[model samples]
Target chain A: MKTLVVDYQAGNLRSVETALRHIGASHEITDDPVRLARAERIIFPGVGDAAHAMRLLAERGIDRVMRERHAAGIPILGICLGCQIVLEATEEGGAACLGLVPGTARRFPSECGKVPHMGWNTVRSREDHWLFRGVPAESSFYFVHSYYPAPESEEDAIAWCDYGIEFAAAVERGSLVATQFHPEKSGEAGLQLLRTFVEAG
Target chain B: MLQKRVIVCLDVRDGKTTKGVRFEGNVDIGDPVEMARACYEQGVDELVFYDITASAEGRGIMIEVVRRVAEQIFIPFCVGGGIATTDDMRAVLLAGAEKVSVNSQAVRNPRIIREGARRFGNQAIVLGMDALADRRMPSGYRVVINGGRVQTDLDALEWAREAERLGAGEIVVNSIDADGTRDGYELEVTRVIATGVGVPVVASGGAGVPGHLVEVFTRGAADAALVASMVHYGEYTVDDIKKVVADAGIPVRRQGARPEAGPV
Candidate 1:
């Protein structure tokens, strides 16, 4: 299956593409919403500021296409800032987001061990999601952001990690699956997680 | 619990992993990508690749080398040497590197740290500092650049504080005095910077034995330690070093071990 890695001029698309290739999956990195319209699976991988990313996505009309795709039951995976933009809003720029997932991204309080919480940390599985089938609970994934998304409903949370406070590490609802960590840069267990998602298609 | 990290550093010149004493009389070690794979399999937490041949012309080729290494290894790795601007950081990050380290360039243009951190987020940028023992300096250590060929007026402690203020996510502290001596880390200098900086500090250079790792992680107050000679000389594997570190009552995640991490 050909996967569309939506590139709105933000995020680590190259690393995500490398991860997909490592799993023997074919993917196209593009910013065109028209091409994404035919996507079998769309991965909204991101890094950088959520407000700016949302603007870039809107400029290319990709946000609309993404919403349409989600409504059609197509699988979409979001990572870090990609996951944040899917929420209703983010505190980074006091900006509104795609609203695909009902939540808001808030910055981790300075009282947290570290603001960005950079490096490896454990993520706990909240449910038996296909994307984490073989990924053992407590598996450490790479995280590099200060702001984190808090899903409006607890039921949407599939995995969680803590820095200053307990925040959504991975959220799932119907066909949407998102993680705040960079699975592409994560190690062997992370590869297993990518393989599970790629093979699920 | 956040586990202490054991990072293996590879000094690459012309795409070949090389080892040198005090940054001179370098000898080719092996293929960097292959060596990186071997180290990862042995349970290294991270890898830092430094392109020793600081040339703009060779960077294009070095990026390909980084791409190949990223393709082969699953763990996060950092690229340092010759990174001068935000665009240079982008070029390497886009090539699949997880972090970019700036040393000489960061000194010449301190804004590069803020620019890189702003463009790529703080965690993606690392400040590589080469420091030498100096009694004349207020901090008792001076910042050295250009591969230890030139000493600067900047104090090691003060520069580290400035780097953090400008938005560096991590600091890799290398002591030119203890470098390659394998006697151990410069605990005095390392403790000064590690305690002074808000960001995580990685201790680099002068690691000889498992005991040194313990010393740096404990008394040195380092968040992580970068090893080169001890592992490069084939006296120890990444696992052996980690086992030694863990045996000393420090927490470390064994590579590919049970991933179940409980809320501790």
Candidate 2:
């Protein structure tokens, strides 16, 4: 299956591309909505500010295509800021996101040790899913963000993490799978997760 | 819970990995790209590449090396050592580095921190501080630049706070005195900065053995430990250091026995 990595010019798309290449997955990175709509899989990789990311997505009309692809039930994956932008909104810049999932991205409280919550952290799977296939429970994933997504319904949360607060680390609804942590940067576990996403089902 | 990170710092000079004692007496080690891939295969948590000789012309060489490493490794890596402008930061990021660290340039023009943070989120910008213990400074540490040869009037603690205010996502507190000594991390200064800053603090320099990493994470309150001489000189592998740290009850990503087909 061809994987199309949605590039909204948020931040380093090269890492995601590199990860896909390392896994030997056939993938292409593009901002063009045409490829996004036609791809067998969509990996929305993100970084940077949420407001600016949303602005760029709207300006390029990639937002509409993304929503369309979601509606059609295409396999969608969101990483880091990509995960945050799919929520209803974010406290970072008070930006309204795609609202594909029922939730809001909230910033970690200043008292939460660190702002970005960088480095390695455990992501506990809430239930068995294809995304977590061959991935052990409580496996650590790399995270680098100030905000974490809080899904409205507990059922939508596939995995959870703690950094001062127990928040939704990974969420799933239908064919869409999103993780607040960067699986692309999470080393072996992350690569395995990506490999499963590409090969499983 | 967030686990402490074990970062390998590769100080590159003329496309080769190099190390020195207190920023002097430098000697070339090996090809940076090869070393980087080896570190990745050894399961390093993160990697930092500092173009020690980040001259105008050397920039191209550094970017190429970064690109090569990025292609071979999937983990988060940072590039530092002469990123003066956002354009330079963009070039490094575009080359596949996850973060761009600013040291001497950041001290010279504090605005670059804000600008880099504004353009590329604060998390993408790290403040690489080279500090030395000084009784004259209020924090008992003075900020040194130009690979620790130049000392400034700015107190280490004060500069760390100011840099954070200006949008530095993380601070790497490298002790010049402890660097290359392999005794242990300068715990006092590292702890002061760790507790003083809200962002994650990475203790750099002076890591002789795995015990130093454990001490830095616990006593020093560091979120991560950056090692050089210990691992670079083949004295200890990244796995060996991580095993000792994890044995101390610190939650490190245990992938030593992780198989290619097994659950990670």
Candidate 3:
């Protein structure tokens, strides 16, 4: 399958590209809306602030292309800030985001051990979703974010993890699948997740 | 629950991994790219490359090593040493590193932390500190720079808190006294800073055995432990240390381990 990694000039695009290359997936890295619209599968990977990323996406007109692709049922996987902006909005800069999922991203409180939650943590899948294929149970995925997505409905959340509070680690709605943790950086289990994203879908 | 991280540090000088005693008496070891791949395959949670080289040409070589490592290793890794400006951080990240660590340069000018955080986001910035135990300081520890050659008036804990407020996402505490000793971590200093700061604290130096890691996590309260001599010399593997940590009832991300953690 041809995979397109959406670049908004935020996040570790190189890591994502490297992971895809390691998985033997045919992929291209681009911010061009035309190329983004042509990919069979889309990997929306991001880091940094949501407001600035939204501005860059708007400037490139990739936001419209993403929404149209989602409507047409093309699979899109979001990571970190890429996952956060998929919600209706994010508390970071109080910026509006793509309304692909019904929710908002909120920052972790000071009481949650640490704010950024940087390290490895276990993610428990809620169901037998294809995204968890070949992924062992209670596998640890690398996380480095202060804010996490709180989806509006419980049904949309496919996985949950606890730092200070139980928050949505992964969520899915039709062709959309997003993870607050970095699968590309999560090692073997994470590599399995990317493989499932390419083969099963 | 977040598993305590086991990070293998590769001190690079002239594109080759090196080791020293208390940050002195350095000697070349092996290729950094090859060593990084081996550690990744061994299931190390993370990797940190500290460019100990002090020349402009070495910086270019460090970037090249980072690119090659990024292509092979799938886990998260950080690059540090001689990174003085935002441009330096950008160059490293663009070459394919997950995070850029600022050490002695961050002490010389703390604003680089905020500036780099602003341009690249706080999550991309790490504060690497080499602190020594000093009874005269308020926190009982003094900050040192230039690979433990210069001592500063800044308290170690104070510097850590300030760096966090300035937008450093994480703090790495290296004990100048305990480094390269192969003894154990400085539990007092590591504990003090780990509780004082709200960000994740990494304990470095003096890890001779797996039990030292368990001590750092359970007693010192460090979120991660950075190992060099113990693993670099082939005395212990990353999995060996992790197995001991897990056997102690501490949670760790063992590659393809049993699926004991079911649905929440």
Candidate 4:
């Protein structure tokens, strides 16, 4: 499958690129909006700040291209910070994001133990989504984030992971699937999730 | 319910993984890529790669290693070393590192922490502080940097608060006194930082037994526990540590395809 790994200066692009290669998928890592626009599937893997990342996207004009890709029915997967940027806005830096998914990204309550809920977390699948094919319910995926997207609809959530409180760990609406955990770093279970995404494409 | 985390740390120098005792007597373990893959097969919850040679070399090679390991394994990996600027953090992240850890650099330039968190989001930035117990200090622990080679006047608690304020998502408190001692974690120091910071605290150093992890979680109030020597030498498996934590009534995510029987 042809996949475009977004390069917005905020993603773990090489790692995401390497993971896609390991999964035997043909992928290109590019900051060029034109290349991204032509891909059959897109993967947005972000690791830096939402505001700065969004600013970089805006500078490159990739944000508009991403909105176009999402509207075109192309399967897109956002990992970690990438998932947060897909929301309407984030409290992290009051950054605006592509409102492809109806949600607002907010910091995990400080009372909820720690700020960034790092390490492995169990995600309970809320619905039958193709991205979760071959993955069992309550499968643990590696997560490293302090902010989680609070989707407007519970039906949009495909999986949930509990930190201080339960929050959306994975979201799916139409052809768009995004995860707060790094599928590239979630071990075999994560590989299954990526394989499902590639197959769906 | 939050599951207890089992972390395996790899100290990398010149592209090889090494482990030492009391921060001395360094010995080469093996290839970092191979060791990391093995840890993944053993179901390690997270992996930490500390570039012990970063500051001295004035550059970071762990990024390439992170790329290699990311290609081979599907597990969260944290990279720490000579990360001093936004460009450095961006380089590592672009190389495939899930989290970039800042230590001496964060101390020297607190803005680096703020800028990193602002650009990468707080979750992708990790502040690694190596602390040493000092009775005369206000917080009773002092922050050490440059791979524990230099001591700073900053108190552990104060530095932790500043790190969190600057948008550090996680804080890994490494006790230089207990590092590689294998007696246990420095609960006193870890507790002070964990209680002071709003971010997740990862207690590193002095992890000799499985129960030490429990002590870190309960007494230290740390969200995750990190170990290197014990797991690297095969003294204890990640699964063993999880069982010990689970048996202690603390929740831990168990390996395999089965779902967690209880509410997560």
Best by DockQ: 2
The 10-residue segment of model 2 chain A with minimum total lDDT is A33-42
**Worst ten-residue run, lDDT, model 4 chain B?**
B255-264
Please tell me what DockQ candidate 1 reaches: 0.47
Counted clashes in each candidate structure: 1, 0, 1, 9
DockQ of each: 0.47, 0.74, 0.69, 0.55
Off by over 4 Å in 3: B21-24, B256-264
Cα-based lDDT for every prediction = 0.85, 0.88, 0.89, 0.82
Model 1 Cα lDDT, one tens digit per residue, A78-189: 8888888888999999999988889899888877764667777788887677788887778778777888889999998888887758888988767888889888878887
Reference-based TM-score, model 4: 0.87
The DockQ-based CAPRI class assigned to model 3 is medium
> Which digits, one per residue and each the tens of the lDDT, describe model 3 over residues A20-95?
9988999988988988877779999988888999999999999889888888899999998888998999999999
The reply for model 2, stretches above 4 Å from the true place, is B21-24, B256-264
CA displacement after TM-score superposition, residue B249 of candidate 4 (Å):
2.3
Q: lDDT, candidate 4, residue B245?
A: 84
DockQ score for candidate 2: 0.74
Q: Please list all clashing residue pairs in model 3, or write none if there are none.
A: A11-A47
lDDT of 4 at B86: 88
Model 3, B22-106: lDDT tens digits are 4468888899998887788778888999999989999999999999998888888999988999999999998889889999899
Q: Rank by TM-score, highest first.
A: 3, 2, 1, 4
| Local accuracy of candidate 4 as per-residue lDDT tens digits, B1-264 | 666677889989878898665556778878899888777766777788888774544244566787788778766678888888888888777777778999998998999999988777777789999999999889999999876899999988988998988888888999999986889999999899888777788999999999999999999988889988777777766776777888999877777322222211
Q: What fraction of native interface contacts is shared by candidate 1? A: 0.40
